[model samples]
Target: MKQDNEAVGAQEESFSGDESQSLVPDANYQEEFSWFSVILPFLFPALGGLLFGYDIGATSGANISLQSPELSGISWFNLSAVQLGLVVSGSLYGALLGSLLVYPIADFLGTEEEGTYHCSCTIPSWGLITAYAPDLGVLLVGRLLYGLGIGLAMHGAPLYIAETCPSKIRGTLVSLKELFIVLGILLGYFVGSFQINVVGGGYMYGVSAPIALLMGIGMWLLPPSPRWLLLRAVQGKGSIQELKEKASFALSKLRGRPPGDNVSERQIEDTLISLKSSYADQESEGSFLEVFQGPSLKAFIIGGGLVLFQQITGQPSVLYYAGPILQSAGFSAASDATRVSVVIGLFKLLMTWIAVLKVDDLGRRPLLIGGVGGIALSLFLLSAYYKFLGGFPLVAVASLLLYVGCYQISFGPISWLMVSEIFPIRTRGRGISLAVLTNFGSNAIVTFAFYPLKEFLGAENLFLLFGGIALLSLLFVMLLVPETKGLSLEEIESKILK
Candidate 1:
């Protein structure tokens, strides 16, 4: 009996060693990645995408009601563009706050120490907020705080997904996060449309905000990443098995695992040890500042510039003010514009779904080329519509929908996917954060400036400018963006440097 027990122990040790080797195996990680392994890592990050999309789209729908002529007397619309900008930028402000604090929070929440969070659900308890209660001032404050909450949640989601996932499916998973983001937008638009059409626009706000809160609360169903669990869970602090159980539950939705069957104790221990070792290797990889100091310049340029080009696509311009843009083009009032914009949102959701499904099979560059080409074509037609016919309202409308579809299928998902793929694991969180921040910063800038630019440049020139940028982006992708369809993170990293 003693001999039998000893043999079992030996087999476990051997399994651990083999798993460890697999974690940083010297050669091609691409060939080894499987679907089961790739999908589970995306669960939380995808939720972050959902939150971003939902919150942003919810606002678009809610804005129509918020800014309606009937409610113009309300304090919400009493403020100037600066104040409204503050309100509109409130979430981004929260996101910035969250971004500032995410690393530490992730360290604390995700770390295995005794006081740290061992379960995913614990975060919402910390993030519990009441942004929509009474006063306009209170609601604004709450919204800013909610943005921070989302910011805190958003940073961790993609970082976790990128690091935990293998490269073969990394692009797909990262893109899934973006897809969920678009989904949230579509859902918010759909829900808001129904609410606004049925009741007043303010009712739309009333309906959507609480829904976000409820979803935030639902996050607890998943386990802490097993990587976080074994590496950071305190001794007697968290049941590794509990984390595994919860992770199995959370991961089940993404990968179709039965609640408890997906993760085992041995798998938890192995992944954790692998992450710890990977973390150690990461420590020596390079400093975030130092990452861009030397031979990494080419990569830094690509990563940074790609994000900039992503914004230049004029996608957010369409999203943030789609209804307004449509209305300006003669679509009726803001409410009708929103209803039509929802159709655009639906197109975005469907195309994004297509992108996610085919990204692995179709390859990144082709999608990007196709997307950029489509954006140029759509924008050119749109500019002509605006220039020739007082923005031939109907054509403007159709072009906008096509623009959204083109973006979702190409730049939207691939941008995030490539950002994750292009950077090294050691600097991945920081690198991806830099890329995401650039994305938001550019988004905020363009969003605020689009109105002004349209005022100054006129609608035709505004789109032409974006179309020109899209052309430049096409050139950039053709020249620099590497084909990363089947490569693992490490393999991609090696090839990029070589």
Candidate 2:
């Protein structure tokens, strides 16, 4: 009884000691600038998504802008569907190559000290990185290379941010990628339409490429993911003090302390050691295939299926071709239709911000089900309007806008947050990459098929197809995916798989 009392006293002392230690200094950033810190990390993930949005939006919009005299001299005008496919899928194909190639580069390019601990294990060693051979005959080789970078950054960035940041801000931060996606779409639509009547030079007239370039360069300024550093150090048993400082900066922000608090040599060593013991074989770790081994398999299915659901809603079809879509419904001219599409993109951006603000309070499953369910109902109504009334194109357009609003509030940003949270640290990068690649592939299929579907089944049936898919996705989310809002990655992994 005396010995038990002594042990209990020691445990109490340790708990009290940590609790008494201030979470922050006198000048706590979290107290004064809490909102900014919450919103800022969210922006980082979106940087890559923004580029993706631009590439997607620009291809169609830029193509339309190129038909005039200013662009008539440019060779891009004579491009065929194969060429168009190259232009459209350039970023996606780059993403695919990057997705496969990142494992090796992330695995072997850097030692355990460079904030890429798992790189030594997760990456495969073939030169599949060059699968995006610049000589693919597209004139936009630079854009393709840029796309490769975007793919790498997009896959790695969110995982890095999600792992490093505290549980308090994780959802908001991951959702930022979604915001950037919407922003990029808006920016692309705006830039592409700016001088639509100006001909060739007009399409190339503005800062789309420059903006993408600037954004890519800007990402370098953000801190390397701390988890990457800890994982790397686990392999070599050597500490990288610089990497530790970066990790400290991130943790400091989360704990409401200074940028370097809890970042001492002892802390670094402890973190690395814990990660090493937890992951067991960092090299044989994080493969897309490995996610199916045990609990990870369930997590993978949830992550991949959620993303697949996000795509099946036909949201991309509405987004990618909103201009022509509105024009088809007899809205003003093509130019006006494009302008309205830009407005819709803006609306998406606005709604996404609302999501960031409220996601934690509202919870993930609720928003997801509500968003998809609402959109499904709206799509069905729009189909009815189109079938019954000749002048119901405006109704269709209004319903589409509402659908974007629903998606923006729910699956648009929530899916990314949920995927980032669900996977454990060991398989995080590969798991999320698989989700992203699945999203892109499904997006590509949906984007390509929508036109053919409309052509074959007519507009009414096309919407019915989307409505049914949305309803099915909603049911799946309710039945399978549990709510993950406000949970830490560790808590989520342990609770979810169990």
Candidate 3:
């Protein structure tokens, strides 16, 4: 251990002496851009996000179908409003459990392997169970299992994308995960529209099974994160030379370069030194408590706060209950409401694309502040329509559309993107897991409480409260969130976190 400390000290001195090279591996070296290189790695991991979105979209219609008299023959089909909320929000509670479960084990498991486990195991199991379930108890169990997969996937996917992809396009790629999420939602709405009349919504719950199986198979073809390999090495998983050899190979695969590439070799050395320096003061790898101290605490504040606001402002509740909300707003027929949800889904998809294209170019804070302000305005408009203009249902529809569009641009994508960006790599897994736990925890609360709250406060008052939260969120972004447009992860830690 003493000798290891000496070697790390020497490497740090060599790293600091080099004035031309920045701490970020990508900052010092520029590889020729390859769309294939970038997109191939991103595609499989993003399926995790798609599954998350599909759950939201499919459940929206399922909520409607469960209320139909056709299935009322099932013993447990006739549910109270509170029981119905539990049925709707079951996966979210499971997601909260999944996030907590993964926190301590994330570093040990690594992101790539976690993806494979969730996709192959939890996701498919839930689909099969939910599809064939004959009772409400069985259905809730299946949804809870599925939520466990979502918790794992959501935590791993963004971290994998951010760490492996080129920094220049980091924001764009991470934001694209949001694109997949909305795409899944759109696909779910389409499926729900066709299957709304089908008893039990079996096909709707079963759709993700085959896709998840394929994604699990595809995950085997992708390389593990290079940074994760180096981190493990620093934790004494292997020798220094082994760390170099393994990390260099992973970097070559990620960057579409030859195994013997000199640039990849240099990056491995630099990253190792950086990792060592981060661990210099510690006796072991970062503990969960480490996430609460100093720089990691700051990251948690920003990342956690964003995700908290993301849910408390009511995005999940709106999407999960879209069919019911629209029906209440004047599209009395379930079919009409599901069709309108498709339109809303399409507009959301389009708006997310704008963020995907512009996140790297326009920076983070401006988009967040602007888009959140729009969200607040739309929420207030929704409240006004419900309160005083109940006669005009079109106003409610327009306001709902505006709310969905604005959220797609800002809070929907940016919140996750920033969470993946803000943490130091050493404690990144724990930090992000905690943030996601907060997210799903908040989501479960809002979703489960929606019906009761709507009944108690009325739709207008509920929306007005959400609008007030949105205004507070906008203020939080302006004052606290920093612009992370183009910085590399190491640069973010050394510069921004400091």
Q: Which one wins on lDDT?
A: 3
- Clash pairs, candidate 2, are 70-200, 70-201, 71-200, 103-123, 104-123, 106-119, 107-119, 117-232, 121-283
State the lDDT of candidate 2 residue by residue for 50-168, as single tens digits.
Answer: 76676556554654544333544454455454454455555555555566666556644321122221121112110122212223353345444545555566676675555444444
Candidate 1 pairs with clashing backbones: 94-148, 111-232, 112-232, 112-233, 113-232, 121-220, 223-246, 386-391
Q: Candidate 1: lDDT of 426?
A: 44
lDDT of 1 by residue, 385-484 (tens): 8889664678888788778888887788887777766765445556656665677667667766766678789888999998999999999999998898
> How many steric overlaps are in each model, in order?
8, 9, 0
Q: List candidate 1 stretches off by more than 4 Å.
A: 1-45, 71-79, 111-139, 162-171, 197-200, 230-286, 294-297
What would the per-residue lDDT of candidate 3 be over residues 56-128, giving only the tens digit for each residue? Answer: 9998998888777783235566678898888889888888988998887787888898899788655555678
Residue 468, candidate 2: alpha-carbon lDDT: 96
Model 3, position 269: C-alpha lDDT score? 78
Per-candidate local distance difference test: 0.61, 0.60, 0.81
